[model samples]
Target: MMEISSAFASGFQGFQRASDAVTEATVNINQQAAQSSNQRALETPVESRTGPSMEQSLVTLGSEQINAEANLKSVKTADEMLGSIIDLRV
Candidate 1:
């Protein structure tokens, strides 16, 4: 009986660790996304034939990047929530 309880406890701890790892990874991804956006904001467009202004291009690119980041955050949130639920079950 003691051995069984110990095994169950060990498994639970492992599950908790995995949840923590996922949370860490999600945070890191979010940080990277924010940094990438900042870098994009600082980038200047190369001289080209008259067309859209550099500011306009930057705006469009930034908007697309923001949308992508939002989607990624949503996915990470869902994954974190799922992990929490699983941890609770365990």
Candidate 2:
């Protein structure tokens, strides 16, 4: 069905978005890790720790991984459906 192609496209887009988010989360984690505690303390007040913390970045990374997996599954399902359609036609 036409929906199969649409599902494949949607899944690919979702996977791309998840991959980008994972990259951003990794970058945020690296930045947070690279910044010295002393420098952060001096620059930001105790109450003003506005940037993403290591825990949050890690969580984001995990969530994005799950999202990517789900998207990949959708893509595989679409591929299978397409293959079935071709087989039936033949």
Candidate 3:
């Protein structure tokens, strides 16, 4: 039971990390968008493109969303497992 609780704690930490990554990605996407717009206004050539491409940013955001959802599922599963164990012991 101690081990199970530890595992769930670890899982929760992982979820927290994933949530941080999502936040970082969102900030990066916003920065990239601003940079791209500025570059466009300057009529910069495509060869001089900087930061992540719009498509790449969108893909990253999508993947992060999936990861967050998976993490949430894991946390829920862990909670249910713990509950079951407690009920069995009782």
lDDT for each of the candidates? 0.54, 0.90, 0.78
Model 2: pairs clashing at backbone N, Cα or C within 3 Å: none
Error of 3 at 72 (Å): 1.4
Identify the candidate with maximal TM-score: 2
Q: What tens-digit string does per-residue lDDT give for candidate 3 at 44-85?
A: 864544666667777877887788788778778888889999
- RMSD in Å for all candidates: 13.8, 2.9, 2.3
Q: Worst 10-residue stretch by lDDT in candidate 1?
A: 45-54
- Report the C-alpha displacement of residue 53, candidate 1, in angstroms: 33
lDDT of 1 by residue, 9-87 (tens): 5545554554554455455555555655776798844333344444454454555455555545555555666677678
- Model 2 spans with C-alpha error above 4 angstroms: 37-48
Instruction: Please report how far candidate 1 places residue 35 from its true position, in Å.
Output: 0.6
* 1 or 2, greater by lDDT: 2
How well does candidate 2 score on lDDT at residue 70? 100
Q: Write the per-residue lDDT of candidate 2 for residues 5-32, one digit (tens) a residue.
A: 8999999999999999999999988877
Candidate achieving higher TM-score, 2 or 3:
2
Candidate 1 vs candidate 3: which has greater lDDT? 3
